[model samples]
Target: MTRKVPLANYLFTRLRQLGVGAVHGVPGDYTLRALDYLQPAGLRWIGSCNELNAGYAADGYARVKGISALFTTYGVGELSAINAVMGSYAEFSPVVHIVGTAPRNAYTSRAMVHHSLGDGNLRIFADMYAKVTAAQANLIDVKTAPETIDQTLEQCMVQSRPVYIELPSDMVAAQVPEVRLSVPLNVSPPKNTDEAEDHVVSAVLSRIYASKKPYILVDGLVAPDGIVDEVSEFARITGFPTFALTFGGGIIRGDLENFHGVHAGKFGTLDFTSYTDTADLALLFGPLLSDTNTLGWSTVPKKEITISLRRTAIELGPSSHNLHIKSFMQKLITRLDSSRLSARKPTPSLSSPRDLIKNLPEIDPSAAIDQDTFYLRISSFFRAGDIVICANGTPLVGGRDFVLPVGARLINSSIFLSVGHMLPAAQGIALVQCELAESGHTPGRTIFFEGDGSFQASAQELSTIIRYRLDVTIFIINNEGYAYERHIHGMDEEYNDVAPWRYLEAPSFFGAPTNGSYKIELHDVKTWGELDKVIKNAGFQDGKGLKMVNVRMGRDDVSTNFKAALQLAGRQLMADAK
Candidate 1:
């Protein structure tokens, strides 16, 4: 007496079971029928402007809500979204990319479909996706479809990476077993051997006891690996000073006494790297040491002094042990003796981001806003629990200097470095926030800091935001063109120039109403005083509806870190050319 369900029902229901509340995608002929099952499966369908934007939105949703789903038609749609999925893969976002592909007959007969290449092959896209995704499920057989979907989603959750599922149109309505839906997915990491765990624990504890000056370095992977709470507790329990990499800015609680500011390597103010270099024991959690994140790799501590914790392994100096991060953290926290550990005072030279910003020379209120003081001054406008999304380029550099309020999260492309991410991603994040708030969770504002060039890449998604009426505040850093590019190789090159739009008119052009029914406020700022006033306004802070602020700055003005990094890049390019 096995119950039967439509294949689409089983797929979408499994997604819902894994905590996916909404699905993001662009509709196409192949997926038109499959999209209908979303609502029946208790999932909200978000129609984004394009497949790429939909992928970005899904990535953002996954980062916040733990898991997200996206749909796209075969060939063209899937190809367009591959870049975003690759970005998700690079940054460890668990995104289930469900593709409505050509019917089974087309694949079997090798027939050409409208969306596919005129050639007979329909497997090319799925084959391409297999390179970037953790797993692939081509549901050609109805009998194995249920298990295939279950395992695909399980891989996504377990690896915290993207997975591809190619569902042929003909198979959407095919009957499948519903019995498999009752079994929950097992995403927990396999347990480590008792002896291995004990050995690693002993090594770590020995370092803690022997070291005179031990420090902790937090990174972005802590969030994906589900160890932020454990890391926070470990930091509190131990009196060691904690520092976050650029990607790890919001990972650590800013209010902790021993929580130092972001470690910017050589690009940071003098004295920041001194304490890190001199530390005898560095407990590095979830270390994603991209050159940009580590300030050209200048900030990564010496391997001899580092004990790196990863998702499935622990690296102690030159040696490594295969132990689950969660298990190791749990055992280490329980076994750690704070009373026996060394008591080291906070480093005098390493100051908090707030204190650093306060010490900067005050800019004239009437002067044009510059990158140096912009993000730091805007820090005053943030409150606890705010979610700030910083786009790549100037905003990424400046945002790292922001002194995030307690409980705030900074979402940025720290390693992926995608430019047009923050806008549509903000839409997805805001949507998830509203969905969760309905369930008694405290809602937070969705603040997006985007560059003008980056905004244009995915600007069409503004309509989706307006249609949903999400509380999203967008601040476009209008530096006229690609400022980051200008510093690297094209100082005044025509390729770096972006056409200037009447940036403030976005809301009206995107179908926003003039009447006060929906709060759509648009403002532009050039001077520091104007930016200050906009940040202090009641309507801006109310978090009612869509608000856009266009901030105009010079193309040459960039964060000190970015400028220095660009100079190094230019020199390297020159050396290569020679």
Candidate 2:
């Protein structure tokens, strides 16, 4: 039972105990051993194109599992990951980062390292994380390495924040002392007593009770920790409208009254923003109101009160709790009504699937694409058990606003906001859930709403899917350009206009198509007759192989989305001026 700690083995053990599903990064001289160590023990070692993409992929994984891993080489690798780590920290996802370091012997004696910062040089990247992560450990002593792993993981798990562990390649093989690695010891969340809880509670209830148009702000953490029901009932008891910041809180449940919708902020459905801006009081259940959640501080209602509980966080490590509204809603929410709230049936404007197709333009073979019109068609096809995975650019803007069903997860890289997020994310969720389905553990469908700009970045993993042969569908919104740039910066006579490719042909390139029926089809259904046939074909044939459908979107019809985003931004800015 006395296994001398190989640095990789110890770190791997620590990651698994902390619930890290996968460690993603392109390996370099510094990270080879850690990457090899992580895989054999059941944790996935996913190799992404660049370090930045790996960071985003880890963030995507954390979105579902609530914990993830970022493995990278030293210096540049660690630096690349900081933006992503900061993003997750802001949103409260637990991400474990293992940065490869100089091999113990060579690095120890070297006084001046090339990538080292000033002062004859030391690793400055570890210090950079001090503001964001709950803990950062730079271990030099082999004897104390075991304690290093325990302390760092403890902070990551309990606080639901990120933790960085720096490992010198020198230490990877260094014979270290043995230590016990087990499930984390029990720890209590910071508790509030009667006096502390009562005052905040009374203030919250009084605000919620008195306001005729009161509401609940359900952030990402509320539902994952199993608090959705209590907050859902709170909305019912007070008959308040509810919303989600980055989405989680039952905004899409459809059972609550006047469910105004999730706080899409600058990136959400247009109507929802108006409701959030005007609400008299906001009982923000457990949201951090991170930068991504706010869309670069694009908008916030000044009149409303914002409250967050112990579990529902308002402040992060070293961050301030900024709010004008009630900060005491969490204590009061537990005691509210639990009965099923009055329901509002969604009257779909695109009433029927036929109606949706009728409104949608036919997918063109030669014509360029855009994210807007494709979202219209894709939204129309969504089913009960299907979850949508949106990429950062056109795919997210094109699709995240679409109404999803209850129990249908909407996975996106909203926090990290990086490209290539959709492919790896869809791969991770699809692989996990497919395994679950095979074992009869769960039943659901996952569809990745990805774009060409993203897909091309990480499309090398296409073989992994066919080799595993998972049940999932990837809807490639092929505009052929970086579509987000197209939206923000117009394509008027600019090189933003990219050449088109036969994307459906990609599966063949991977060489491991599903059942050898790897399909490559361009979707072009101008009318219901063509569209229905296309959908029916995809529905029956998705699991048969790697199905790539080239959805020719509304590239030229950017007016609607352009206006949708800018108009909202403009009106809101004017309101803020007021």
Candidate 3:
């Protein structure tokens, strides 16, 4: 008995089938009716303060839960979230962006709308979205709406990037056959070719057997492309010295014997630099060759020595192959002869500067905290099964140095550099964590390393966290201003300074109880002793509800890499002035 369902139900039902537990967005005239179907389709509606925040939340959710959906009204709403969607495209986060559009009659008649620019061009929004998303679908016809919906969603999953779809306001209740609901959408990866797989595996294995010094360089793509388990297994099987780019922090479990931490070019530790730079063969998986990820492109292994595995192709030195990387990894894992692989050299402990700093003498209780000592000390607080997020400032640079336990996920923008993204993203992740816990799964805590400047940008979203009472812990690096920007261009400019707020009062200001079931703990730490005490506190250890820790540092305080970059920039500025 095939039932006729509304187009909105058909779309939301497909999203639910694809494992979308919640949808994040803001309501508008065009999308208000579409919002009504969310609950009926068995999806939770998380209304964000704005469209951009909703998009950021959706991106964060996607990173944790694999796929997420974000709804926005046409024109005004969609444009606001374009940056977030762009970030998703740049980083390969799978997000399905559905836009509630003007009715078909309005589009046919060129009717003027308030949200539009009044040029009678309703297609402009979809056109703009096409540039940022991997696929786009405009649903004006009832006959092909289901096919369009499934196709657009399949693109989002296949490419691990955003896909755009337009749902007209008046077409929400249009009749559509619900037969497709029983059949799951084909979101699987394309079938691997036997010839291509054999060639890629043979080439990679040949290089592995011939090389004297072989290394594995993991990048951020391991998560988006669904190959973390494969990569981990490969690393374990080969036991090769493994390193990561800055964006690849949490993907490789730090506890692994082969894991040697992130490779920061000349900026990395002596052993890290020696092993990576002197490698004869490098297996670079999911390489995102951004300047930030590669330490200004210095850490990128020589092209002749690097075998790159991309999403759709494989590149070995100068030669290239049209083979899927995920497929190549799967075949290589099964075919590789472990007995023939080179024996790994027993390397010394690759403790980061953070690790060494923790061994230093205890500082004065009244002494102010700095980047080097602060990040390492804070690393001790992170336990297993925690999702750590960092803002686009000192926290971004410093938090990457923290050692993550197995099962930890680190979310940081390598190239997007959106400052306020992590704050609202933490909110979305907290919501997802709550859902995972209710299903009898191992629930993880959402931990954020945010700057005061970044926190101010998305401060209103904290209210959403309190309303939902999601388990989130935020450590506000209250460094007084846009510390990252200062290191880049304006070192002492007034424009970089942010407005001062009582950072510790955020929970109460956002409507949390003073002392009740949803009890929010607050801490203001200015020294190492205070931070240590707070981390060891009973309330913080419980990790139940919202916990806020505000640590004050100098405005000029930044990581060593940031300091070096700042010095180079300063010299360049001086030369230009001359």
Candidate 4:
């Protein structure tokens, strides 16, 4: 006789097999019964304060763990979290969105449910999800449920995007065959035809060998596409100059001799821009050329001389080929003849963030901490194995200038540009770090750089972080309002301002223990002297459960690179005014 398990049990077990250790979401009426199967399936249920934060947390967890799961009730709950799911789709984070809905009887009878639109349209929410999710399945039959679940999850993994599943309340306890669980889901993409693969490889190598000044640009999608190692190895073996866009920063090893920092297009130094402009050939990996990622398209390479390698296709100038990036890269690397490639010397004039920091002149300690020197000064605080997250607004802009250590990962909103994403994302990242530490891996601290205005949007999540006692260090740039918005359009507009709060008291207010094995530290710094002392303290350097630092800066002051973009926007607005 074949063994069987409940539908919810089978679903949660598959998620566990996919390496999702925790399910992030809020407890809702429709999902309450299904939640009972999580722990039995070896998964933890993290009850978030709201569905939106839960969605953001799931996205963050997926970034660290490769895949994650989120639970939400029907219409209201799912709709609230839709924006976050859209962000995951835009950025290629794999998230399993399992939504619990009313019983099959309600759908068959066309009954109006509490969460529904009152017009008996039960499918509206699922219809909306179909637009953003890679795949969707309504599990109504036990016999077909297992196969459907596996297929949808496979799509989520292969595509590296969100997928949706509708679990009827009555089906939660329905029995399903356990035999299918014995076979692991296969998520590998289809192999390219040998003839097609060979043509693309030959084309790439021919250009690479013939070019005098060749450069490699790694973009944000490389990580989600699982090609970071391959791309890094290619760049390493070639000994070619390589640079990452803002979204791709820290994915490649930063200590490489030929590794330049982030290329910010028009905002970059003249020497750096001049070097890239003179390249005879350019190779792009997982290129995501959004306006914000490319600094208003200023960093895009000349199309005539560029070759872009995507997950499913390869673009060579005007021609396109159906080829898998991973398979093609493997073949190209094996066929590379290093001796045939042109040799070029490294440009000494291009200065990295570390070089700029080292050459800085001493300043008055009593002087207020300004945006021009803040990110550079804080660069020394980062260490290897740190997972640094920057929220949208000023943090994202200034964080591009960080000189990350080897093994560090920098995460920011490259396309979604959500304002309050990093704080809860830090929570998810820190939870994974703790889980890794318990499993005998060297755990890293979750460092978050947030804007004052953005922090208020999801401040309740801080209490959840304190309850879990995750190791997270938060640096809040208190510029009194949305300084990033101020620079873009309004210099002193009331709409750009945020209400002031007692920022340093957040730890206690969030219920961090006053005395325990885990300690909480809070500091308010206004001047360069105060900031310097806080960073150098032994307690602050040690990765603790909860640490908060409030650094005050001028509202109009922004990073130099960001200031350039803002000035252009200001001029555009002025032109519109006339």
Candidate with top lDDT is 4
Global lDDT of model 3:
0.85
Assess the local accuracy of residue 561 in candidate 2 as a C-alpha lDDT between 0 and 100: 33
State each model's CA lDDT, in order.
0.87, 0.60, 0.85, 0.88
Q: lDDT tens string, model 4, 1-578? A: 98999999999999999998999999888999999999999999888889999999999999999999999999999998999999999999999999999999999888988999889889999999999999999999878999999999999999999999999999999999999899999988779999989988999999998999888898989998888899988988887888888889888887777787788876753236787888888898888898888888888899998999989889999999988788888899999999998845565766677677788778678999988778878888989889999999888878777888888999887889887887888888888898898889998789999999999998889988988878989999999998887888877899999999998788788787877767888899889999999989988988787889999998787877668888897787799999
lDDT of 3 by residue, 102-159 (tens): 8899888888987988988878878888899999998999999899998899989999
Give one digit per residue, the lDDT tens place, for model 1 in 1-578. Answer: 88899999999999999899999999998899899899999999999999999999999999999999999998889999999999999999999999998888898898977877889988888889999999999999988889889888989998999999988899999999899889898887778888999888988999889999889999889989889999998998886889888788788887788887788876764336777888898999988899889877887889999999989889988888888888889999999988888755656666777687778777678999988778888888788878998988888888877878888899987688887887889999999888968889888888999999999888999999998888898889999899988888889899998998887787788888777778988888999989888889887897779888899999888977668878888888889999
lDDT of 2 by residue, 1-578 (tens): 56685777877876776566567777878878767777656677777656766666576667666678888877777787777677777667678888887765645465665556634445566678788888988767788887877878877766778888888876776676554665453433445456755655555555545664545666656633445556665656555555655545323464343454545554553445555566566565555455545555543445335544446343322333332122234555564433422222232321222334456666664444444454555565666666568777666554534655566667654455656656766665665565456568655666777767777767766655654565567777665576556544454646566557666666667665445454434453334355456666655444433555666555544325344564455466668879
- CA RMSD for every model? 1.5, 5.8, 1.9, 1.4
TM-score of each: 0.97, 0.78, 0.96, 0.97
Off by over 4 Å in 3: 269-271, 349-364, 569-578
Cα shift from native, residue 161, model 2 (Å)? 3.2
